[model samples]
Target chain A: MIPVTVLTGFLGSGKTTLLARLLKSPEFARTAVIINEFGAVGIDHDLVEAGEESFVQLETGCLCCTIRGDLEATMADLVARRADGVVPPFERIVIETSGLADPAPILNAIMSEGARGSGLALGGIVTTVDAVTGLATLAREAQSVRQAAVADRLILTKSDLAGEAADLRVRLAALNPRAPLSEALFGEIDAGVLLYTEYDRLDDFHTHTHHVHADDIQCIAIRRSEPMRALTLTLLLEALADHCGAGLLRLKGIINVAEYPHRPAIIHGVQHIFHAPAWLEGWSTADHDTRLVLIGRGLSEAWVLNLIAAIEAEIAEIAPQQAPAPL
Target chain B: MDEALLALITSSLALWERAGDVRREAGGAIALESEGHEVRITRAAPDVPFRWSITIDGRARVASSVPGLLRVLRAGLDPDFRPSRVRIAPIGITPS
Candidate 1:
């Protein structure tokens, strides 16, 4: 599946500027960019330079609202064009949404379509925040808060203009403690941080831990060394989606399922939307523990722990009763 | 009946890069003149799916949606703009 990274932020937050610089990277040479502007005309298309085998298509409308359907349609079109050799063969895709938009709907469109075998996987979400006024925007707009909350990597832009930004860091951690926060010096960002990987990279999980809490948003990490039954994992996620809904901003994990202990399952979810379990061919390390990082508002780590234990016990009870005698 | 449509048109203009300014004229009519081209938009009768009639370069066209209308305007005013076709996926993806 081709990985598609979502780049989002608030208006004047320097998303386009970062994208313009990102396109120039030798690392992103084969990446196709889809630029969505929140108005009748597209001004961002003019700002971003199209590189070889790389072109930016503009979606005209709010990404979170009237044109969300268009976003899905656009994805299918892009894949078809790539298959037919109408466009350059790109290994990945990057969607840059309008600054004033909510990112949840856009994320849902991609994950749902990707599950249909369009050969697209949600690479990761990279949200840009203008260090100068990011705190104000987050305080004023729910969309801004959600945008920052869902990112896998949050890029704080124009940090040179702002001093220290210690308060902004604290607020960002409170809103999304799971996502590793970094500053982009004048739109210059490291491409590797935004690209989607197989969850093998230890660096991603090791980068941060839950440090601060605000706005009822908190990051919860669950790790169990015992290999879990796949059925129990599904049951747990179903319960999560059934109960959590939109408060669950994002869920990412690399799990060791007992039924498929040889390979690992990469789990990703945004609110009620979730990608089908992406089965990896192999494990990343000798330590095969299940590690899950969830960023959510009003979610309880204690509840999740109790729920997992209950399901594991119930499954263990039933498997023994239904077991076949050794021949 | 068409106040929302007018607001969308105005907001779209403000967001688009090439667009200059949107002007509201007498009788609730709206006009946008940018890059030496003028576009006048008014809501069409309710019977048609195309909700609005847009007149540009002395030629009139009907648009069924805001995105459709944006296409019409881009075709008229932006010489470098090219329209891309979009289609929905064939099957629904499920969480396995």
Candidate 2:
């Protein structure tokens, strides 16, 4: 699967500076960069220098908004065109989101929307925090707080210009004690830490998992022992999309579709936009049953359980004879 | 395919916002009605290579795919819609 990394921070968080430096790295070479701007006229593309034909500029409102469809289609088109020799063949994709972006949905889109058979895997979330004003920005802007909250790695930019960050570090740790924090001085960070493989590290798995109590964002782990009909999963996502809305931030997990038991399906979604379900070759986990982690705002585990049961029951009564084909 | 086509149309109508109304017609066809113009979209014949025939101002335009039909509909309907020119950075240094 192709790894897609998301780079997000507040305005003037020095994302561009870090991106400029990153583009020059040997690891980032052959990377397809997507620069997303919030306005009508995009200027971020012009500000940074990447591979001339590898950077895709997405001025689709915001990454978390209605224009998420654009993001999926763009990636799909890129993949399709690349296969047809219409676009350049890049090894990986990197999305640089607008400063005000909510990284959860954007990450969800990448993880989910690329879908089954899209050959895309969620890499990691790297949030650039402005060391000079990051403390005040985190306190003032809720978006910045969320961006930092969901990141796997937090890079404090402009650290050279700042002093005494004990308070900021404390606040960050309080908000997100899991994300490994570092400073991006001279617009440089060790590439391996940001774009690392083996995302499923057992030792630090809890660190990357969403577990913020200070913030409303918390993760709900949904574990099912029995194999689920693929249709049930689709209906569940649809029901959640209709009911949850913004309350549902990100959903990710491996599902054991009843029909395709050998190949587990990877499910992902950001808000209402659910990516096409990707089917893996085989079960990665030793103990198979479905396992899903939902990080959201005010997510009721009981309500979700009831909804799934209700939908499954309704489907069973309506079409008891036959289970719909695996999605 | 039908869902994708409908989504594209639905999203475009949302973008248009009150400029035109899109509704499902009988026999799995879609009809978009604006002030005086009505564009009927129906799946083309199986033998035909095109996917859809978008009828606007009593003229029909054939589009081979979903995106093609979208372009045709936009050209016929919305004046403000300008497709963003997507630029993919050229291939550069490869990683070892």
Candidate 3:
């Protein structure tokens, strides 16, 4: 599956500035960009200097709300064009959502059945939070909060202009404790940081505390030393989706499956949509413990922990009964 | 075992942010009432392959696992609930 990264933030949050910098870097040489603008006339494309053959501008409406179908269709068209050699063979795709858009629906589009069938996989979410007005925006805008909450990486843009970002950093940490924050001055930052999508090296997973924000958004991390049964993991995800619904925003983890000791499974989900577990060749480090980070609204850390324990206990009871007898 | 199961059910209700009450009934069955809906959960007979029998609002269904039970409960309680389907894809991008 071709990996697709989503670039999202609130209005004037420096999404285009970051994209322009990324496009100039050699790391994004073989990348295709889909820039979604909310208004009638699209100008973000003009500001970006990517190869025209691989660049797409969606000016219909907000990619999250009105033009979701268009987004899917555009992706399919890009894949078809690439296969037909109509455009450059881009290794990955980056979707820059409108500043005002809620990224959940756009993410759903990329992970939708049609997009998956077209060989598209979610790479990660990169949300740009303007340091000057980020705190105020996050305070008043629900969309901004959701963008920051679901981001895999949060970029603090224009930090040079807005001195003393300590307060904003604290606020962002409270809202999303797992996503690593990077400061970008004049949109100049290491391009490799934004392109790294592998979940194997989740160093930030160490923050295992439950952080609850005023908007009912919270981040809960679950860690277990014992390996979990694959069935238990499946059932746990199913139960979470069935009950939590949209309240469960983003869940990503590296699970140590009992059946596969050496090869850990990488799981990711946005809202109700979850990608199937991806098995790694081997554990990245000696730490093979299961670490899961859930960012959402009104999530209970104890409940999730208890739920996993209950499922594991049930599995243990049934495994013995279902074991094959010795011949 | 029953206590853990009851705790899970209660926590499940709380996770959904719904006002509900879960209590053990007379015959070792669990009863859940929320938003004018009634649910009864009982262990299946030893001879049956299913693990639990769940009856919601006079409708009966058998769940072979805890996940199945949650699905049934969500369908009965939340009218707009849709189970998120997981799809397996290739782990990473294959360069052309």
Candidate 4:
């Protein structure tokens, strides 16, 4: 699966500078970038050099409103072109949204029906906030507030110019307590932490996880290798969806199941809506363990652990009855 | 206001009040309308992609989802809610 990272910010939050720096890193060497600018004239497209025709500009007046279909088609075309070797090889994809654009629709398009089979999956949402004026802009612009609210990572650009970054950090924490806030100097940041590669590899016997540190929120990773019954996973997901839909930001994992050993299931969820579980032809890697990362507001790790145990126990009880009648 | 229109006004008033808005009225439709600036929003056939119709000065525009409907309504209600095109710009170094 190609991990697609979404970069967004309010007008002039320094998203492009950050992208330019990130692309130079060896980690992003094989990455394909799609930048959306908010004008008929496309200067951002000219600034970045990735591959010929790889830089796409969405000149539609309002991308968030009028260009969702266009965005979907563009992604499809990119996938098709890549498969046909028409474009340079890329291991990852990054999408930079215009300053005034809403990131949610773009996210929905990626997770929607026709796009899933194209081998593109959402990596994470990174929002850039101008350190000097971020707080004021967020106060005035509802779109900016929502952008900060839904971010997986918050990048504070122009931190060096500020007398103090503390006030802006405090404001961001209040808006999105679950996202990690990082300071950027001259658009330069450590790509490893900024990019979404938190948990790339897996080990079945042992748990491999990343603990996302948030202000009052915590992202908990639950790793289990024991083969889980299908019904157990269903029950757990149902409970989560029903009880904590709004607070739940995102969930991503690969599950090892008793019924399907050869094919591990890829599961992801945003709020109450859970995407249809996808079964991979083979494990992304040899480690057969189940890794579940849950990002939410004020999540209680103990509660989640108990909930999983309870669901598994219920499944254990139901499995005996679910056994097939004698042939 | 018609009965349904009055009720819609009442409910919207309640909703607006609950959401901390100051005032709402049932004088006319706020979005797409054929005769005037009033628009009618009702459920569309299940098979249709859009579930709502917004008529602006007798011109009806269908919307697929609530968000889409709201977008139209907002554009009509607030002139500043312009949907600007997206452009490509380098993520820059800004003053903190």
Candidate 5:
């Protein structure tokens, strides 16, 4: 499946700036980028440099709502053209949604349309938060909160202008504990880390030191040394998927499952629904630690920590039941 | 398990498009019953080798594994079912 990354953020959150930088990278040489701007005058599209490959500017109101039909038609056309060899063969697609857009509908379009959705797997969702005024914006703009909530990787932009980003990081974490927060220096980061592997790389279970935006919100990371038993992880995921799936917004991680140790399982979930975990040949990085980051609204850090501990303990006691021969 | 069985489940789920309701019950169970067919999804015991088991119309069906179960579900719901590609991947491979 082709991976498609969705980029969402509030107004002036540096989404366009980030996209501009990313499009220039050699990593995006084979990428097809779709930029959607709200107004008729699409200036943001002008800012980004497009290679000989496909670069579409969608100026159809709100992409998820008013222009859904148009967006679908555009995607269909892109697919048809690509299939017919009418366009360059792009390996991946990235959508830069307008600042005011809601990403849920956009995702629904890709997932429900099996041919279209299946053909292009959701690589991940990336949302940008303006470091200087992010806390106030999130507090006042519910969409901003929702945008951050659904991100697999939250890129904190304009950190240099802010006094200190530690407080802003905390607030973002509280809104969406499952997303791994990374700072973007002048809208740029290592292409290897920022470009590919969308939501699949977010490690919500591990606690790493981050420049927390505020002290009230705690960002924690958990890492497991050994492959976790499949049943234990499944149960834990199911419970989370059942009770607080919506709150989860986004969850991404590479898990070392005992059932399939040689091949790591990559998991991605949005809200309550989760895609069936995909198997990868081996760990992408030399470090095999099971790392996960959780960003959510008022999610109990201690409760989550205890839950993981309890599940780990239960895994040891779950022996397979044996039965006598049925001769 | 086969194309016919898969079509049956897809039709039933597609029927509820207007309602937009998806149901998953306790103990990781899912049931779908319609005019003539029924489907139930249950988790298998760890020793079974398969992670999931699905029964169609009260009759046990065979799926080699969880990915296989997803394949079955996709066949039932999706009109187009090429195992490697889903509904949205670019049909042709040429770079544009």
Candidate 6:
């Protein structure tokens, strides 16, 4: 599977600076790049130096909104061209989303069935935070907070120009405790570390409490010891999307399906778009508890727990009558 | 079950960021009023496949499940409440 890394940040967070530097490195020489910029003209692509065969610039609109459909088509075309020997055979892809774009929808597009069938897998997400104005941006922009909250690796860019942002680090850590924090001076950092990270299983929620930000964006973790039926899980997701709407920003979980006790299902969702559960070979550890992390705006913990309970109870009550009888 | 439904309705309203009132009426019915829209939900007869009877503006509709009931309630209460349909990407390869 070809891994796709999403590099995102707020406006003027030095994403292009970082990408340009990475493309010059030996590590990112064989990588394909997709740069998305809002408005009629995009300048970020011109800043990045790479071979023309494997580089694409989306200047139509933001990848998360109007051009979401175009993203899948673009990747598919790129894959086809590579297979046909039309373009260079790049082993990986890096999509640099627009500064104001929401990463969740872009993620959903990458994890869609069409992209997966074309041999694309989600590598990881790297979000850049400006060290000089990171605190003020996080305070003023909800998009900035979301970009940091969903990242697997957080890079503080332009660190040489600013003093130590201890408060910003604390705030980011509170919002996302699992992501490792790194500092980049002039967008220079280790490319391997940024591109080759895995999504960490949310196992620390037992000790860490749910965090709510000033903009009403919240990080909620749900853990279930009992395995859920596949149907129950489906209903739960549907209910959440129907009721929460945009309030449900992102939801990802490693679920323990009752029918498949050995193979766990990995589920990822953004707003209403949910990827079909990908079954894993086996549990990584002895613990088989289902772990879910939900980042949203104004979501109540008790209400979510109650919603799950109510759905399970209702399903159990009707399952017996709906079960097929022996001949 | 009524208590659970009441809580769910209350939370649903909060999630939508709309001001409303959800309360349990006598005879195990849950009533909700928001922005001049009124909705009442009650358990349906056991003989029918439908599980709940949702009444909106005096027009009663039978809902097959709790999700269906919530959909109706949202339609009545919030004018801007457009249900985001869940699309499950098909797994495995399809004919290219």
Worst 10 residues of 4 chain A by lDDT: A198-207
Report the lDDT tens digits of candidate 5 across residue range A1-327.
Answer: 777788899999998888888777888877777888887778887888878775755564778767455666666667777889987888878888988887766765554354244376677788999999888888888778778876768998998788578878877766566567887887786555456555345432335533232322334455677666666566556544533444554555677776566666665555555555666667656666665554434344444544455445433434444211111
Q: Could you give me the TM-score of model 3 versus the true structure?
A: 0.85
Candidate 1 residue runs with Cα over 4 Å from true position? A113-116, A196-203, A207-212, A321-327, B1-96
Alpha carbon deviation, residue A208, candidate 4 (Å): 13
Q: What does candidate 1's lDDT look like per residue over A1-327, in tens digits?
A: 888889999999998999899889888888889998988988999999978979888887887887556777888889999999999998888999999888888887877744346878777888898899999988998889988988888889999999788899989977877677888997788877777553634224653334345886777877778777666676667656644556788888887776667777777777756666777777756767788887777676655665576555545544666432211
**Model 2 chain A poorest 10 in a row by lDDT:** A201-210
Candidates 2 and 5: which is better by TM-score? 2
lDDT for A115 in candidate 4 is 71
Model 3, CA-based lDDT: 0.81
All predictions: root-mean-square deviation over Cα?
19.3, 13.6, 4.4, 14.4, 12.2, 4.1
lDDT of 2 by residue, A171-288 (tens): 8776666567988877888776667632342112432223444566665666777787766676566555544556666666677777777776666666666666656677555767
Q: TM-score of chain B, per candidate?
A: 0.71, 0.73, 0.85, 0.45, 0.47, 0.80
lDDT of 6 by residue, A56-148 (tens): 555558888876668999988889988998878998899999999989789888889899889987878899999989999998988898899
What tens-digit string does per-residue lDDT give for candidate 3 at A283-306?
767888888888888788878887
Say which docking band candidate 5 falls in.
Answer: incorrect
Candidate 4 backbone overlaps, count = 28
- Lowest-sum lDDT 10-residue window in model 1 chain A: A200-209
- Candidate 6 runs further than 4 Å off: A24-29, A39-42, A50-61, A174-178, A196-198, A201-209, A320-327, B17-40, B85-96
Best-to-worst ranking by lDDT: 3, 6, 1, 2, 4, 5
Q: State fnat for each of the candidate structures.
A: 0.02, 0.00, 0.41, 0.00, 0.00, 0.39
